[model samples]
Target: MSPTLSPSPFGTAKTLVLKVGSAVLTNADGDLDKGMLRTIADWTSERMAAGCNVILVTSGAVAAGRSALGVRDRNLTISQKQALAAVGQSRLMQIYAELFATHGFHVGQMLLTAGDMEDRRRYVNARYTLEELLRRRCIPIINENDTVTVDELKFGDNDGLAARVAVKMQADALVLLSDVDGVFSANPKTTPDARLIEVIEKVTPALIEQLCPTSQTGSLVGSGGMLSKLRAARLATSAGTHVAIANGKRPGILSNLVAGKFVGTYFPPAPTHRSQRTQWILHGRVSGTRQVVVDDGARDALLHRHKSLLPAGILRVVGTFKAGDLVDIVDSAGRLLGRGIVNYSSAEMDLIRGHRSADIAKILGAKPYDEAIHRDNLALFEEVTSAR
Candidate 1:
């Protein structure tokens, strides 16, 4: 039997991340839709009046950039696109500032690159800034620093960016406003009989593979489609944030979504609490400099007994990392097993590999502890598997 769908605890959410997609905020001509902006601003202001802290992640800089530069060509190079973003970001923010001010609300702009979250110190600092803004009752309007990000570091879309923001802020809910009503069984344009999936309790690998196949041409300014939204929903929901994908073109959509109107597809939060540190590791926000591949014995020991990883079980070590740097754990077949902070460096582990705990000091000429990754610091992928 399918699990019953339930509304997230209303008015209990202290912090919310509202993600407005490019298609929702811009017209086919790639111009900002003032009417749509006003509706969103008004609804958000109402929530703020009710004492709910809101952070907005918006897309449209590229669109704004295109309009500002008077570029009608769709095949602009990355450099040209970046140039447009530089010009349009400020213009987009100006519109937001003016619209929000009319509702008597203060807003702050925060531009981030993927690097910001990849570095542990920067991650903490970003969280601190957002918290400070919320404490001061100011809305933080966040967007990816497209002008600075290289292709590899780019979040690819605001939906993924929003998920990262939600994880950073420990937000209770993430509302993704897009052009479509919600996620459907198939691409709505192609499959006229496609049915909307009203609620999702869990996103399985199979379900992830079943995401909409057709890509909706984004507003001249944005770069995401419904598939990106679903991917974002999966990421956010896995991090323990309730996510809703709704139509941004609909009137008062944000308010209606939060008011239990069931306006769009809702991805329910994971039933367990994922420790913040674990979430960061699992999400790959912080890149691990090293990796260790374990055998079946080590995998079983870690997954079933919650045992510390010993040198004897490690088959290979990849990359150089410090003692405290997060590292990936993989199996013999090369699939990622999990991640944990290593107690020894790759150089140190190489000498100690396949050795017993008693031989640690004898082999390395020194020792901190017998285990490579203490049981306490390790989180297994089996936990997620069992949750399913």
Candidate 2:
């Protein structure tokens, strides 16, 4: 029997990260909605005054920049989008500053990339900075370092970043403010009969499959869609942080969520808490290019058997990566199994693939470990064995 779903306890949330998306922050004309921004700031400040630590993860820089530049090309070049982010980030921060100042709140801008989270030292530094900001009673407004991130190092969407931040800060809850009311049985825009899913007890493979086939498209200005929010929720929930997806335009949405009002789709955290290292291993947001493919036997051993991946199980090494680098573990059919720190470099993996563990030293004259990925360094998801 399946466990019953329950609403997340937002009222009990002491540390919160509110992620406001670009679609909700911008008007139909792609201009930043100053009024809505101010409203959110007022709500956030009220919470902070009540002794709650609120960190905001916002997305509207590109949209704001496009409006500021009067450029209408929706399909922008990589460099063009970076340029837009560079110009619009300053404008967005200025607006946040002015609006937050109205409520006597000081906002500090924090831009981060996925690479920063991968590096243990940098991750610690970033965490300390955020802690210091909260200690000083300053709200940290985080966004992707869009100006400098290339395709290789980008977090892709602020939703993913917000989830990572929530885990890093050990936040009690993550509220994603979107244009929609909440997650529905289907895409509400497409399915007229779609019903809202008020509570999600678990983020499973089946749930994700039901979301949408249509690429999770965002506002005319944003890159993320509803799917991204669900992904973020999964990341946070694994770390025992509750999550909510609600409409940013809804009146008093922020306060209402904190009041435990039914304003959005709430996802409860997992019963067992995941360690910080495990969270990073599972949801470090490793790109597709870094995935490694293994055989069905390897997949079974890792999932049902709970054993480490041996060299003989590796079917194919997908990308260039060194030992200690995080890589996705996928099956022969390219379905993602999980993610882990690779024990062997890609070049070395190629030489040892499909070879017996005992043959490792014979082939390369060096064998760092018997397992290609040790169980200690690995984190598995439900998708590892879920029906494709």
**Highest lDDT among the candidates is held by which one?**
2
Write one digit per residue (lDDT tens) for candidate 2, span 1-388.
Answer: 1122234356567899999988789888888899888887888888889888999998888877888999887877888988988899999999999888888888898999888888667877999999999999998999898888776223257888899999999999989998888888877886799888888889875677677455555555567777778888988998999898999888877767766775578888898877998888887756448877999898888888889999999888888988889999888887778899998999999999999999999998987799899999998875554442
List per-candidate RMSD values in Å. 3.5, 3.5
User: What clash pairs does model 1 have?
Assistant: 63-221
Model 2 scores what on Cα lDDT? 0.83
lDDT of 1 by residue, 1-388 (tens): 1122334432457788999987898887877888888888888888888898899998878788878878889777777778888998999999989998988888999998766765667878999999999888888999888788656223256787788889888889898888878888877767899888888887765576667545443333467777677777877787789888888887766656666675688887887767776676665443534689898899888777778999999998998887877788888888777888789988898888888889999998888898999877777663444742
Q: Write down the lDDT of every candidate, Cα atoms only.
A: 0.78, 0.83
- The true-versus-predicted C-alpha distance at residue 339 of model 2, in Å, is 1.4
Provide TM-scores for the models. Answer: 0.87, 0.89
* Candidate 2: residue pairs that collide: none
Candidate 1 Cα outliers beyond 4 Å, as residue runs = 1-12, 152-155, 212-221, 286-290, 319-323, 344-352, 356-369, 382-388
Q: For candidate 1, what is the lDDT? A: 0.78
Counting only residues 3 or more apart in sequence or on different chains, how many pairs clash (N, Cα, C under 3 Å) in candidate 1?
1
Residue 123 in candidate 2 has what lDDT?
Answer: 79
